[model samples]
Target: ALNKRDRIDPLEKQDSWKDFIYNPRTGEFLGRTAGSWASFSLTHPEYFLRLWVGLGLVASHCQNYNAGRTFCQSRMVSQNTGSLKRYIQASFCLSSSSGYNDSIQERNDLCMVGEYTTQDNEPIKKVCQFKRSTLRQCSGLPDPSFGFKEGKPCIIIKLNRVIGLKPEGDPYINCTAKRATSLQMQYFPSEGRLDKMFFPYYGKKSHPDYVQPLVAVKLLFTKEDYNIEQTVECKVEGSNLRNDDERDKFLGRVTFRVKVSE
Candidate 1:
């Protein structure tokens, strides 16, 4: 009779199986076997610890997917959160139509239609109006520097478009410092609330002119807070949102570091 060592899993010889567990280019296994794990931990425990920590970081930062469909309807996922900069400015290439500039949120039953060039055969869908001017200081119109010169930096946060997802309890963004020190912030569009009208995203083929809503957070740093790098975490708060996933820190939130240098 053949020993267990001679009866290796035949599936390991398959290309798909190899691709799933090993990187051909890097010559590294995606995950280790029991024997390999034990050997690595016994020999190089620090490397093994760092490997797990690296995996945790990747899981926390990566975007979540639903079923086979992507969470974002369009290319909006790439713009989920803007880069952390000393000063951030928001720019837009919006339609000149008067309706696109409306700052008021329409009734839930109604939607303001946006203008988009579509083929005659495509079905018409209502795309809600997201006023870019609501960002005020971050709009890049009033001050191109976006408050950077004044020591108050503006950061714009926009949620990725999730199809058929409607936030409950009036979702809003709340930003706080990770450290014990206080971090003061002021929000544009009042309370950093993500308006309801911009949700329930239709696909790009249907809602071609759809624009995601934005919240501008202006950090109000005191003289003492300046020159010190502070880690800030911003979360979407609502009855339906989940922001407390220990394994995934960005479930309904984003964390970034910022420092204002005078």
Candidate 2:
């Protein structure tokens, strides 16, 4: 047989085989031989400690991935909910009719005492009347007693801004004479009472040609002994109003202080 040293493979001692344990180009450490491990621990103990600490940190972070994922999902949900609420609130609002401010609440003044005459220059002594049912269809007849006409005393209520999403039906106006029940107030749309087709207002910027809906209020003094100075509350009811304290707070009202002078 050959000698033991001569039987050893010469390839095992080559540089390529020695470099296989640690690749400098790829910065990867393959499994070291027993002798190589022992040599590295003794000569570069700090590097070995750093590698062990890095492995421990990586293992701990991997375990927290589920917790981090849950937190991210919850934060995203909260952000989405907040955005939706803001969008809903901004989509609808009630505004003043005078173009003075964008608010539902307002105050107006009217002259109760006037020599309201007809086109024939005839003074109106009795209360002028226009039935709510017939106002839309009835064109202004020559008879001032029947329809809305020029020289007739009337209160003009114009809704300058109405912001809302697409509503189901057209919004109508419901007016009540508060405190001054003797005062007769009628809804006088140039056509009739406010029609439902006017609403679900897109924004002013979106509909530049949008015209504000106007409601003409014709006030008539039914009683001769009415107070000289009276404050009348007229409420214009809106749709889907919130009820609070047994009252619909979303409804807008205008207080008209009328002063009658002979």
Candidate 3:
């Protein structure tokens, strides 16, 4: 009876702790506990030690264990690093506006264009419409047509390269302008306007119809004095952004100094 019990105990332990075998729903605990192993080891130290060493050898032979661990670690690192790099690449640039040297010093120029009459002799105020040709034409020449003067001063903020964004659905970006009490910033598109359907750029070589998007911001000076110089900060917000820190990290920001003259 004792010999029979001994054979049964070994079989029980083997069935309980089979490596790599587990129930997905309930989870696997191997069949027995450490206490049971301890009790059996006391009676059969040689057998228990042999089983323990053999299990270790088996585990070491399994390459999937080490590979899985390494894969998980690599994935975590890539995610963190990729997020930071994408945030850095996203940026904003002033594409077209009024005042200063349209070609050389446009970015630093404080002069803004005011309201003026067009070829049709119609009154045009508070609107600065910029197109692709406008940017190309104004690129290095001091063109007053691109300047933003007093009553008609409007600045166009172009959304530069945004990385890690996929172009599938309609994803848009929201922008807010921070400035002094007398200045007002208005964004075009009425709502968040980056339109993900056009983004996640597939490179010019791949997609021929892809056109870079732009954001229009009209700068309004409400003070009595028309001639004033002040700095305005524009922040671009996205749906994926979570907190203030992420905004500062991932989103793009642009600062413009405006001086509207009479």
Candidate 4:
């Protein structure tokens, strides 16, 4: 019964569509669709919990890492300690990897006394003599293999170089097993003693022909000594040498692992 002119047509209604399509004040269209609005309103409680746990774990890991770094920095060697720190080192004899020549005659043909012509205006430093014959069976003279083929191996120990280091008292090499076990080893040159004459090595320019002293240890391995690795620690004992410092593990000692195959 209503007149068509008086009733409002749905298509002619402007407010609903106008605000969604365009803004008069900003002169811009409202771009958010129904799907975008739903996405923004949605909430995932489980994902929020997971994210919080992950962040907490990352924070804890970073804190622990910083603490460990600080501790290690504190344990670093002090700047006052000079480079003149002396120690001992062990090496395998007559092996290709050990820098020894594969030839029998060439490697063992070294002289006891090094021959060098002193330079002019340089002080003549006394060069100590070290004969390879002193090593006896471990010298590669009697057996070129140094007893490796028969399960015995020769280990050579040498003192680290330090200028003006005159070892007071007699310095000797002593080796022992790591565990509460015994290892049969024979030292060459008698009682593993390092002669006093070998001390006080002058600089290379002053003593070009100087030869460092070496102590050879011949391992007498039994049947039980094969296949399993044996840890050995050798220390040089003297008046001034120290091998028991917790701060410096290898102050005057050396450690090595050896194994012989049948």
* lDDT (C-alpha, whole model) for all candidates: 0.55, 0.33, 0.34, 0.53
Instruction: Report residue 23 deviation for candidate 2 (angstroms).
Output: 60
Q: How close is candidate 1 to the true structure, as a TM-score?
A: 0.58
Which runs of model 1 end up more than 4 angstroms from their true locations?
1-122
Q: Per-residue lDDT of 3-97 in model 4, one digit per residue for the tens?
A: 98888777767765786686575454565665554454343111111000000000101222221112123321111111111111112223222
Residue 11 CA error for candidate 3 (Å)?
Answer: 74
Q: Who wins the TM-score comparison? A: 1
* Residue pairs with clashing backbones, model 1: none
TM-score of each: 0.58, 0.36, 0.38, 0.55
Q: Candidate order by TM-score, highest to lowest?
A: 1, 4, 3, 2
Model 2 steric clash total: 1
> Which stretch of 10 consecutive residues in model 2 shows the poorest summed lDDT?
49-58
Deviation of model 1 at 254, angstroms: 0.6
Best by lDDT: 1
lDDT of 1 by residue, 1-262 (tens): 8799887576766765776588576555756555776676456322211100000001111223221212123211111122222222112222222334455434112453222222345485555556657777755456645555566766667676554455667778888888886788998778988777666566677766676677778888777876676777788886866777787665777666666555
- Which residue pairs collide, candidate 2? 170-196
